[model samples]
Target chain A: MTGRGDGIRPRPDAAAAYGAMLAEQLRQGGLAEPRVRVVVADLLDHVRTTGEDPVQAFGQPADYARAWVRPLSRWRVLGRAVATAVGAVGMFAAVTAFFRGGSWSARMSVTIGDLVVLAVFALGAGVLPWTLELWLGHRAARRVGRRPRVPDVVIRAGVMLLVLGLLFTVFTAFDPEVWEPVVLGPPRPVVFVVGMVVAAVLSMVRQPRSPALPRLPGTPERWWERTPGRPGRRRR
Target chain B: MIVAVVVAREDRESQWLKGVLDLAVLAALVREGSAYGYGLLRSLAEAGLTGLKGGTLYPLLGRLEDDGLVRSEWVTGSSGPPRRYFFVTAAGRAELEAGRAGWGAFAARMSTALEG
Candidate 1:
């Protein structure tokens, strides 16, 4: 079978190809459709049986049924708003603590610089994986059986980066002077802007596909359930 | 069964498995003299060491042939199919010999250590 360049291009096997594409789109669209949900479930079942990448055959689903849908409760929105307000106030307090000096201009510069550095750390750590994990988690969860476990590697790496990002942000916020080399150095604003542009470009590029899980010689025999020839036969 | 499940996602252990490919494939040929893809696959399955996937096996066999450890010939079988049968080369025999010595030493040491 011939492969196309991008976007799940149609193949000679039009029917199967179309079905896979449509099923994927439906999966992304909240996975609300029972039939499409079954298709996603079946795709996962095949992965469990054949030990292949389910999305390798298609692509990321459109609606991402396995993704954590935001809770519909009004309480969730209210709670989030309250927490965000608290965070905003804490951030103001942090900035207030940093700039207890006489000169207004100098304090503004330091505060703005601190905010930029904080933004870098959060983007590098939080925002990047927060966006990525939604899709990654959904894919990992749907790769197996009815009860999906978090893909350990993705979970571990994401959490590690987030924690490190938090530490970096906290450190940079408290000690804005540490970033003085870049902030006060020549072509200051140019450096920050260039860095942001480079980061945006890098994030846009598709992450490299990880190597396939190693396939052992005799594993498939154990993966599938065995059915007896006679219905009532005693078998372990 | 328990070990297989536990080690399923251990990538380091899987890389180590790659190091054993030549030995495993060579051992299969030593037992059968020569065999085709499905034949070797079945032999491995019967040996209760199964997890090999398609994306891995075919390319590995190609690499082995390229390295001259094993040579392949296309022949029509009684099953009405053209199959590529692989036979171990002299180099393969040498590699197997070295592996045997290493494995023997490792097994002996482990046995002694474990018993103690």
Candidate 2:
């Protein structure tokens, strides 16, 4: 069958559109033809209302898992590692201070900080499995476009890590005998500033190209026409 | 009168050809063994099925493959881009012969009906 000039038809590269059309054609030939008609109608509805390629819409869950979920998960792991390293150093400091006849309160406080850092690190580390599951699951779904069963093992593992991190933080914060420090070394201003700069640069790097201005699918353009109101006159 | 008869004959054949094309494509693959998409499309056009677009042909090939009547494999052409080539299966060949028989029966019945 030939394509009608219905705007609802997907522009060929949209794989989901291609799949839906194929499904309709096969079902019509072999099984109930009305079933194919209903599917085609639904597909047309999806296209007309959303202006989204249906396949791509189904792919949003995978995309979200990729661009946001996996990254956040990994960053949380990295945070845990940073906390652990800092805590380990605090532990060493506590031990040294204690040996040096440091005040009971001061040495004890550093020891507590060490414990806090380690706990956070341990909790954060558990997120790795969940991150891995999300990544692999998304990749598989993209290839086949079939519903994938989310592994309970991965989910439980992720929950376990989060709980562990929370428990550590709670215990450290609430303990009575473990003395808490008034300040933890220079307020971490340098780390915060550096982190903000790095975060800004990363955000800038990962920004999605606006899809409003359609580019050739899966290919780059030779020249870009800058939208009006942008800096600098158009250059060849 | 002769010119009018020729024109009428051409119109009837064109109308008949249009309906048979969907089957004609299946017959070509069943007979030819294998064909590249563009090559098959061009050949069909040369045989009088004209105005077929690249967009229409590619999707049809994909649908045929999906249905298992046709199978495709990607091969890198000398041009360096991969093109999907299609060949009919045993079932497809059987279906083509059945369709051909059905077409002949239908044509005979229609001719008798029209004459009556």
Candidate 3:
């Protein structure tokens, strides 16, 4: 099928592996799903038509993805943190409700210790993307004839996990009298849905590029009239 | 020694192509009106980037797509699965024009120096 390698066909497994990894890497890089779909389709078509083994054509999926899309964009990181916070609150509610025999939808109390725990969870969620990227980077690098220091990242991740564990223990161990807020937060379901919605909205929001001047490349950052509906840019 | 020679040649070709591969892909799209991913690579190969692989080329296509330079759509013909065909946008044409001028000046200077 290809000019150089006529009549060759790609192994189905290789094509599948390449396509899946490319899609994942692209998604993690913060390209929206539809864009990711189209980009992946284009690459797969190239492989099918050219009859090139996916590996022969693409060195490593993560490396190829990094070349195309900058991973761990700010918007994606925010979305992740919000999603994790929502999950943590839901789990905490479920456990408490099970123990106290209370309705799952009951309103939650806002203790300072709870806030501390929530913040710790959200912070952990925020760093999750970077952690995943490091793992992917190490694997991709090793496969592609490059050696990255994997143990250092492993050590760092272990330390972070231990720190998170210590924080969780300390916060939960504090007595209820220490810092319970007087006000009760919203009911569980509403808060959970709202948090999820906020996370969804965050993922969709584009981080604004540095405002390009009307004239050219280099200019001071100036706030111009922003276009409606698009939250990212302030271009005239 | 043989593996080293091959790796060196590969690196040299990619390094030289790095600056212009995206531009060349853009030029091919502008010239052809529209083409699929593999078809575009074939055109590049015919234009002397014969060793260009899909791995290198797709990322360039992706960057072009992201920059609003080229737009793509899926088309299904009588056979095979649907393929994405890319068309150069108006902005892409403007960028290509600017690139053409830049390349011409740079190539002329390099040519003069190499022959001198």
Candidate 4:
């Protein structure tokens, strides 16, 4: 058989390759092992019985995995949107306080330059966490052979520290007097801590009690079926 | 031109199949009483759901289990590796009935619109 084949060779273990790809995709999607095993076993059985190339039969591993993880992905997107909104509000409040020369009063005014600075702070605060997450997730996914779910606490903490540092550097350079009072003010620090605690409590209370699945819009109430995995099906 | 038309039709059919896959899987379980993952896939194929694949069906099955519509258990036999056999719950049967009725109604409406 080898001699007859000459340059031609038998295909590599398509079944194992398919299983590996599917497992990796499922892992990246943050699906537990038992769930991954169930799907992988089914695919292996299909390959053994029909001798069909899984890639040809099932299209791409990534596409299939995306379908499976649609709900989780949606939840993650929703979480990120909420986080971004909160970050914007927090940045605005902090910058405004600093501009008011550390007075936590309602009468403080924001000039155009102050607004510009606020915008810069917002961009840094918002974009740094997201960028860091993407980079970290990519690295984790590659390292673990599947995407690892970085906890919300870790990402949020990193972003908060980085943004605070950025604000300190910028404010100290531009307006030392304003920056000094803001950084050293007892009321501002107390308020920040209290606000964070309240926000955390509210988040815990508002977190959905149901399974972490996000319902696809327009799907029937009890459908429970995943959205089809076309290229543009993602809401993001 | 002919190829394009064929491809378009296939895409449409595939989309329709995906929408109805849950109903089909439930119906299959109801008919067969119980089946393993591969068994269910084969049955669906034999029943003319050619587009059904393990990737799609298994996830749907998992969701069904999550919803308490189906129950599964790992059984070990003398010959091969243990397989998890799935059985439709009573709730699943009720859901299947409702889904069938809804699908029938939708199909009728579509047919009427297309014909008229």
Instruction: Give the chain B TM-score for each candidate.
Output: 0.75, 0.74, 0.84, 0.93
Q: Indicate which candidate wins on DockQ.
A: 3
* Sort by lDDT, top down from the best: 3, 4, 1, 2
Q: What TM-score, over all chains together, does every model reach? A: 0.32, 0.32, 0.60, 0.49
TM-score between model 4 and native = 0.49
Q: Assess the local accuracy of residue B77 in candidate 4 as a C-alpha lDDT between 0 and 100.
A: 60
Classified by CAPRI criteria, candidate 3 counts as acceptable
Q: Report lDDT (CA) for all predictions.
A: 0.47, 0.46, 0.64, 0.59
What TM-score does chain A of model 4 get? Answer: 0.32
Write model 4 residue lDDT over B56-102, tens digit each, in one string: 77678877887889998866666555556899999999999999999
CAPRI verdict on model 2? incorrect
Worst lDDT run of 10 residues, candidate 4 chain B, spans: B75-84
**Fraction of the true interface contacts (Cα pairs closer than 8 Å across chains) found in each model:** 0.00, 0.00, 0.63, 0.31
Error of 3 at A10 (Å): 2.3
Colliding residue pairs in candidate 3: A1-A7
Consecutive 10-residue window with the lowest summed lDDT within model 1 chain A:
A227-236
- For residues A1-236, could you state the per-residue lDDT of candidate 2 as single tens digits? 11123345455445443434333222212222232332233333334333445555334323312211122344644553444344434444434443545343332233455556545553443333334433453344355445457665676677778777877677767766554653343223343444344333322121111112122222333343222121211111
Best TM-score goes to which candidate? 3
TM-score of chain B for predicted candidate 4: 0.93
**In angstroms, how far off is A49's CA in candidate 4?**
3.3
Docking class of 1: incorrect
What is the full ranking by TM-score, best candidate first?
A: 3, 4, 1, 2
Looking at candidate 2 chain A, the ten consecutive residues that score lowest on lDDT are A227-236
